[model samples]
Target: MDLNKIHNIYFIGIGGIGMSAIARYFSANGKKVAGYDKVKTPITNSLEELGIRVHFEDGVKHIDLAFLNKEKTIVVYTPAVPSDHQELTYFKNNAYTVLKRSEILGEITKNTFCLGVAGTHGKTTTSAILGHIMEPLKATSFLGGISENYNSNLILGDDKVSVVEADEFDRSFLRLSPNIACITSMDPDHLDIYDKPDALQESFKEFAGKVTDTLIVAEGLPLEGLTYGFGDSAAYQALNIEIKNGGYFFHVKTPTRLIKEIEFYLPGRHNLMNALAAFAIADVYGVSSDVIKKQLASFKGVKRRFSYKVKSEKIVLIDDYAHHPTEIKAVEASVREMYPGKKVLAVFQPHLFSRTRDFIEDFANSLSKFDEVLLLDIYPARELPIKGVTSGWLMEKMTLQNRKLISKVNLSEEVLKSEADVVVMIGAGDIGLMVDDVKFRLEEKFSLLK
Candidate 1:
């Protein structure tokens, strides 16, 4: 289990956001890193640019002999990887030292002063904001998504402070021993693994039990951690919120001192929660109130989380990585707050068959918030297509009279004709790659309309 003694690192299902973060970490630390992914993506491409060898095929024969050694090499596999995966099978049969990405993260940060962020939602944003604050103070961070502020998911630093998204999938966060941690809204998610909300809550409790010092829970999440909210019950609360220049202006009140007029550029009440959690960690570490205020305002945001594709008074396009029902509700509220009385069109691609089946009612209710809605077929990331579970089913349940299911082929055409004041794209799947395409078509169509 001595990571320092191992030199080679190989990853299966490396294209995932979490796995790719680990791949970058090992590669940056001078380990020979390589991985297998079914599809090449912008993430895997970034890893290759960093000199990490990545291949698309599942064939075990392509693995270099040097990386095949079972002793010096450490194999990391994602939970998404199939049981019959070729590289995984080879590694197991050859008696290689194998670990899940979570285990690897636990091992890597166990020696450092770990600041972990765990929850069903807002983990990425909270962790990134914490990382941004700590990075200025010379902290190493492993994030779930690339930070627009730093332009990278892996923040390299020599100091011991390390911020990371302690993931809940496969009970991953339980492996990490954190000095401080935050649990943002713990909605019932990943039902395929937990089967029920209480089971997931139990896991969160178990994970929170390992924090050595501070643990901040979001406004209303059911947990025993130090409460974080916009009210008095929490140790860290945001109050006197104001909206100025299309961003949020709020006060972060910690136990000792309250930092006023902290300007955060990220949207949504959920983002306010994210900032509160990050500020709580920074405040505990003796980071100056001025530093926290500065960092919170200047923090750009994580990619695909309310990322502005195109913005103008005439036409506004917002892209977000919101898959869960609660996240969608947050995004919708933020959109409404930003553009009052404007006709909003929300385009969503449901991710995962299991999720679609489990939260259909919640999804329907949340997505109905928009004035107009368009739903693409379910992405079905890993699971086989489930019977009676499809976008058509979801579309039928929506209360929005303007909503309809559109194929990716006709998506642009449908949007081109819509009379929406603000257009929002929300999903966590490959639907992101279509953002630029949708933007291009909208611009062209808008020009003609003008």
Candidate 2:
């Protein structure tokens, strides 16, 4: 559907990170945007601040009358929205042109030169990195996460280029047509939709076919494309890496040239690979290596990707959006590298019962890496709670000696009593709200008493 014919955009799940970014895009593009969310959140408040009308109730009665015009309005619904959602049902019955956010994203980037970042874990950071690189080089981008450098999720630039975090959720990335793309991982996830690991991998294989120019993947990903990594064999590989002032300083040798001493603050080897993917895509887009280097160093990472909520002399508390086992491994690996010999305590809230069931063993193995582990109830996002798939069930499988299944109410108290020097709150749920509280409690007031 042509967007010019539509004047009002109604989002069924507007508080979501992806949906909010799209809402911002529509608002910025001059469409009257309003949405209904099931709850009020910091994101919802921010949307209201941006003049996007957001109502917490799910009832159709609360919808603005302007959204009732089927011809003039477009209703966008997220897959997470319940099938019986009243407003969504109203839109469907009233003949409003309803579309998934992925379809809208497809329409948005169809005509532009899209750089799609697809993966289970690194999509947000890679897309934000590419967005930052492309924006200064005159490319517009819509990122999945808020980039700290620009302090925004939507970056407006000239029409020549666009960057998108091509999510694999519900096969969302299949909607994009990218001139160049990068897939950081092919780890099995979303088994509720995929049913098996091979199915998920097959989806990636198909997604790789959509790139008209080059497809860059991490070194070990199953996809056959121009590769980038720390290993010498990759077409574009990073070498001579050093962490200087908490940022990585590395030299990259691409197939064509050697660029020396590029920098970015996002820690972990995974971020370095993310940087490699972004560098490859931007370089193919005709962005100069010097320009790429400059933007890469200045590019602030995506929120919740590796967000440092609290960092003090004795304690370092990180809040990450890692939900998958692979993602947790990356977080644990990075934290351990940064603070060797310090006890690392991770409080994890499992997201989606289906996912928890799908990867219980892997989750258990990963969480066991931490010295102390606190598990919370599964955040049943988009999925009904499955039998025997609770966080407590998952906790029983963990090999970690120090593990507890605690409620959010008691989580703060549990954390307060812990003796660890490093605390990591890991999840893709509302548990991030506790980060600020945890930080405040662990500030100078709780200095090392030794």
Q: Could you list the CA RMSD of all candidates, in the order they appear?
A: 1.7, 1.8
Cα lDDT tens digits for candidate 2, 1-450? 677888999999998888998898889888999998888988889889999999988787888888888778888989989888888887888777899999999998898888899998898998899888887667777888878887777887766678889989899999999989989888888888898659999999899999999888888887788998888799999989999898899898988989998888888888888888999988877889888988998987887888887777777888899999999999999998888899999999999998888888999999999999999899987777788888888888999889998998888788988999899999988888888877777774476333
Q: Which 10-residue span in candidate 2 carries the lowest summed lDDT?
A: 441-450
For candidate 1, give the lDDT of residue 259: 75
Q: List residue ranges in candidate 2 displaced over 4 A.
A: 447-450
What's the lDDT for residue 199 in model 2?
Answer: 93
**Deviation from truth (RMSD, Å), model 1:** 1.7
User: What are the lDDT scores of the predictions, listed in order?
Assistant: 0.87, 0.87
lDDT tens digits by residue: candidate 1, 178-266: 99888886779999999865899899989888999987887677677678887777788788999889888887777877777779988
